[model samples]
Target: MLLELRQLRIQPGQQLLLEDVSWQQFENILAELGEHRAARISYSHGFLEIMVPLPEHEKAKEIIGDLVKILLESRQIAFESLGSTTLKSDRMVQGVEADACFYIQNQAAVIGKNRLDLSIDPPPDLAIEIDLTSRTQLDNYQILGVPELWRYGKQGLKMNVLENGKYVESNFSPTFPGIPIIELINQYVQQSQVSGRTQAIQAFRNWLRDNI
Candidate 1:
């Protein structure tokens, strides 16, 4: 599988799926791919998916992640940003690498840890995915038990909150109560594309000051 991966070239916005992959093979593939690469991987049961994100996918991810950081900072919330870190539970046979993940309520649990073992450590409080290429698998996140998920794509930002082991779409983020997050993210993400990221972020901060 490693040799085949070396020869395979997955273009941006494309995904390669392999079925019947064992857990050991999934670990080996992750080791082979390393952490600095552009491709994102997701494993559920015995299936594996490797996807390369397009430029716009990365752009939206960055801007949205930055916005989340600003929101947290303004609210005086302690948080840790772990960008695209692999979150997997061997016991559940589920694994996923989110575009952006934050340890907000659970920040202290992972403060000094260099590695995460989902079987022991708590899953991220919030996970963000840029679905420009439709590579996100909701089942993977649900099975892993992430509490909150933000998916930004052509349809705009959608927030999914975990309830009773299932995801239910919500307009407000539990992390940022009373802050019209859906409307704010949709408006600012579009603004970033046109007015530039720096300007858009500053504008968002200004809005937060006046409103919140």
Candidate 2:
């Protein structure tokens, strides 16, 4: 069944949405889409969303990812970057591909494991999201038991923490406690627009070291 989907041409451009899709069907399509496909897929309840991200969306994603890496490195924190990796849980009936995700607090639990089972293994400690063209459902991440979510948009960055199957707005990140996440992220994201990615990251690293 999965092999047959690989032979089919499933060109996903823009956003293709489908409602009332069964979990089995969604999994099959995800399998057919393959690991190397340049697209994003999300499923919540019975709805499925597939999107081919635009240039601006990609730019924001890159800047956030770079900044995250710099933060982790400077803090000497152990992390594993799962770049837009497929995260799904059949039991939760939710699936999502984050812009960028990482295992910080639970890095050791998934360090050498090839396959991750959310039922047993820990979900990504923190997931970064860039909302430019489309909005991701925060409910899905809550259902999947993701601890923290950092949502970036035109207004600025917003941090959310999952609490008893619900998301609560937070000024500080649970992943990096006591850090002024929104202010720091907004400063660099805006700076990247002017100084470019490389220079912005370098400046961020320097600032982080002095402050930490």
Candidate 3:
């Protein structure tokens, strides 16, 4: 499997699916892929999906992640940013790698820990995914019980909050309440593309200071 994986050439913005993969095989594949690769993986039941993001996808991810950090810092909230970490639960037979994930309310629980086991530890408070080419599978996140999930794509930003063990679409973010998150993310992410990340982030910080 590892040899075949090495031969697999997935172009950017593309994905490949493999069926009937077991939990041990999934773990082995993750080990083979390592932590520094560009491909992201998601597994559910016996299906495995490997996606390589586009440049546009990564740009949005970094900018939005930075904006989130700024929002948390401005509010003096402590958080741990785990970028593209492989989150898996063997018990549930599910696994996923988020574009960016953060621990806010549960920050203390995972502090200084290098590895997270979702079967025992709480899922990230918020997870962000940039779906430029491939759509993210909501089942893995929903089953994992991530409190907040944000999906950004060509259409716009969509927020999903976990409720009753399922996902409910919302216009507001429970993590950063009372702020126009949809508007802010859409506006600033576009701004970053147009005027560069530094300027866009500075502008957002200024706007946040005045408003919040």
Model 3 stretches astray by more than 4 angstroms: 1-3, 132-136
Residues 1-212, model 3: lDDT tens digits: 24568888999988998989999999999999888899999999989999999899899999999999999999999999988888889998889999999999999998888888899999999999998343446989999999999999998899999999989999999999899999999999999989999999999999998999
- Tens digits of per-residue lDDT, candidate 1, 61-102, equal 999999999999998999999999999989989899999999
TM-score of each: 0.96, 0.89, 0.96
Total backbone collisions, model 3: 0
Kindly give the number of clashing pairs for every candidate: 0, 0, 0
Candidates in order: C-alpha RMSD to true structure: 1.5, 3.1, 1.5
Please list the residue runs of candidate 2 whose C-alpha ends up more than 4 Å from where it truly belongs after superposition.
Answer: 1-13, 132-136
| Inter-residue clash pairs, candidate 2 | none
For model 3, the run of ten residues with the poorest summed lDDT: 131-140
Off by over 4 Å in 1: 1-3, 132-136
- lDDT of every predicted structure (CA atoms): 0.91, 0.82, 0.92
* TM match of model 1 to true structure: 0.96
Tens digits of lDDT, candidate 2, 86-182? 7888888888888998999899888877666676778999987777344445866787889999889889998889888788999988777777879
